[model samples]
Target: MTKFADIKGFVFDLDGVITDTSVLHGTAWHQLADYLGVAWSKELADGLKGISRMDSLEMILKAGGKENDYTPEQKVELAAKKNTNYVAEVDKMTPANILPGMKAFLDDIRDKGYLLSLASASKNAPRVLAKLELTDYFPEIVDPASLKHGKPDPEIYTKGAQLLNLDPAQCVGLEDAAAGVQAINAAGETSLGIGDATELGAADMVFADTSLVTLANIEKHMA
Candidate 1:
């Protein structure tokens, strides 16, 4: 059990950790792939986790052998289209889309006086936060637009901790992607891995889903 006594705050990855937006992202990618006549699979989409939207577009285009002809402007346009689709889908998300026990955990943490922040590679993070009505929960949002590098580099997480006025060791990072877990670990913070355990082998702790990540569970680890 990892102790949370030293932790002063919590930082979360929006897409998979807070909401079921991973499926929406994958769906949007597949839609774009079909429009571009590219082969897009869940495996490829999964591999693109924690990367920026532009980078993801480039990867998918290169994989489809269509990277050479597409202009930068075209790539931007396509990415915007994907966002449009994603936004429409996100608007339809009800409370049901929020992972189980996440609300309870978030309430507990906030009530306990832990500062909360959001660190995500998504450029549309602000929009997503607004749409989900989760804007009030996070005081600081360090996103792709705020950093030169994305996950696997630890810059985002490091900056997040800096913005929150908390030490890396005093923050708990929650993520569902392996890259995110790596980023948290590299930042010297405790990472609670959510979702599929096989992919997040590097996480300090693993839970099957948000439902397993209760305040009691966190306290137990901290103890």
Candidate 2:
């Protein structure tokens, strides 16, 4: 086992990592597609994971053979509608909705004084954290709206490390999507991939279940 004792900070991707909001996001996207009379499937929504909402919208448009049909403003409006749908479920979130092991893992890291940053592709990250009462663990959170690109691009992870005053090499990134794993690696950090190992090839380690994400386990696997 590798000793990850040298790691000083942790960068976490939202959605699938801290909470199960991916289903809500996928539902919202599907609703928008139906409302717009466009075709969308769960498989297509799967591609939107770890990606920005507008970028997801563009993909949807292209899937519908209408990518160039809508002007930028129109696409923005549609994306806003999708966001509205997403927010309706925000109020439903409570601490209980946080993954089984996330709260404990976060508490452990916080107690250890590990600098933590939440890098989410969702602009709703702030609200989600507030609703889940997990905002205190994250002093720095990347606003996807501010970024011109989304995951698979290393900007978010790099900025996360920068905000923590740590070198990317001194941080480990946790994500549940392949693009996010790539982002972490691209930023020169070790990547912890949650969920499917087959889908997270870019990660340094993959855990199918969250229950095993303890500090000891992380150190062992991420070392």
Candidate 3:
């Protein structure tokens, strides 16, 4: 078993883990789909989780049989348009938007001297953190804009570990998306899932949501 004293840090995925921005993202995608005259629903929203902006657009396009109709440049523009809508929604956000059990949990982690970082694929991570009054909790926020690849690629998680000066195996990653969990595990850390059990099947240990990923359970993964 991995012991508590052996772990060096904890890295968390943003969006669903830190706050419920999934709905905002899904709304943006739905708006894009509406503009494309494509029917959008939660099922389509499910495919957007943990994916890049353009990738989500492509998925929606493919569902509408228009994936190949647009050039890469056009796709980028469309994705940017959708992001504008999401940003407007995010601007309305406040600190209460922080997810349940997160503030106290993060405080406890810091109190225990465990290095904490945020490894989000969102280019607006810093903005969101500031809006939620969470900027002080993480000194190292991996630059999502610098990533050529997103979750499930392990690049973000690896960068977080590097920024913290910790080995991947000596860290733990918390996520609410299957792709994020996969990225965490691929980076050699314990992947703690924070969502539906069936959806996060790849995680080392799955919790229903942020509230359930208790410190006791977290320490159990240390080695």
Candidate 4:
């Protein structure tokens, strides 16, 4: 087992990593599509993962053949409406939706004195964290609002590592999106891709979901 002896921090993507808000986001997208008279498919929504809501809305509208009809202002209005619906939907999130093993894994890392932070593309990240009551676990959070570029750009992940006072190679990034895996890889950090493995080829390691993420597994890489 390889040990990352120099590693001092862990950076996680908020949506699919710490919370199950991906489902809510997908539902919102579907609702938005239906409202626009388009058939919503998981295949369509999946392509927008790890992007900002604005970008996702643009992609969705384009796919639905409404790009030209929807002005930027209108897009913002629809996106805001979707966000409003999403927030209401996810208000049901509890400690149970924190994934099967995330809390324990987070606790283990904190207990071991690792600096923890979040790098997420979601604008609703802070709200979701607060809703899940996981805000205390992370001292720093970088969202799309904090950067000019989103995932696959490496900016957010790099910024997150910098905020933790750690080099990119001295941190581990956890994400569930292909773009996020690519971003972490481009940032020159070890990345553990979670959720669907097929979309995570750029990751150094892959786990099916948060259930598979454990301190032991991380320690193995650190060894």
Cα lDDT of model 1 by residue, 112-180, tens digit:
898999998776777777776778898799857668876788888898898899889988999988888
What's the lDDT for all of these models?
A: 0.84, 0.87, 0.86, 0.84
**Tens-digit lDDT track for model 2 on 106-201?**
999899888999998777899999999998888799777778767799999998899899989989999988888999999999899998989997
Alpha carbon lDDT at 142, candidate 4: 80
Task: Count clashing pairs, candidate 1.
Answer: 5
RMSD of each: 2.8, 2.9, 2.8, 2.7
Cα displacement (angstroms), candidate 1, residue 163, comes to: 1.9
In candidate 3, what are the lDDT values of residues 1-223, reduced to their tens digit? 4456778899988878889888788787788899988888778888887666777898899999998899999988998899898988788889899999888889888998899889987788888898898999999999877898877899999988998999998888989878889899889888889889999998888888788767887765443
Give lDDT tens digits, candidate 4, residues 1-223.
Answer: 2257778899998777887787888888888888988778767988876666888888888888888997778888998998888988778677777888889899989999999989987666777887778889887988566798777899999998988999898899999888889999889888999977677877888888788898778767556
What value of lDDT does candidate 4 attain over all alpha carbons? 0.84
TM-score per candidate: 0.84, 0.84, 0.83, 0.84
Query: Candidate 2, which ten residues in sequence have the lowest lDDT sum?
Result: 1-10
Counting only residues 3 or more apart in sequence or on different chains, how many pairs clash (N, Cα, C under 3 Å) in candidate 3?
Answer: 4
Record all residue pairs in model 3 with backbone atoms less than 3 Å apart, i.e. clashing: 2-222, 2-223, 3-222, 3-223
Which wins on lDDT, candidate 1 or candidate 2?
2
lDDT of 3: 0.86
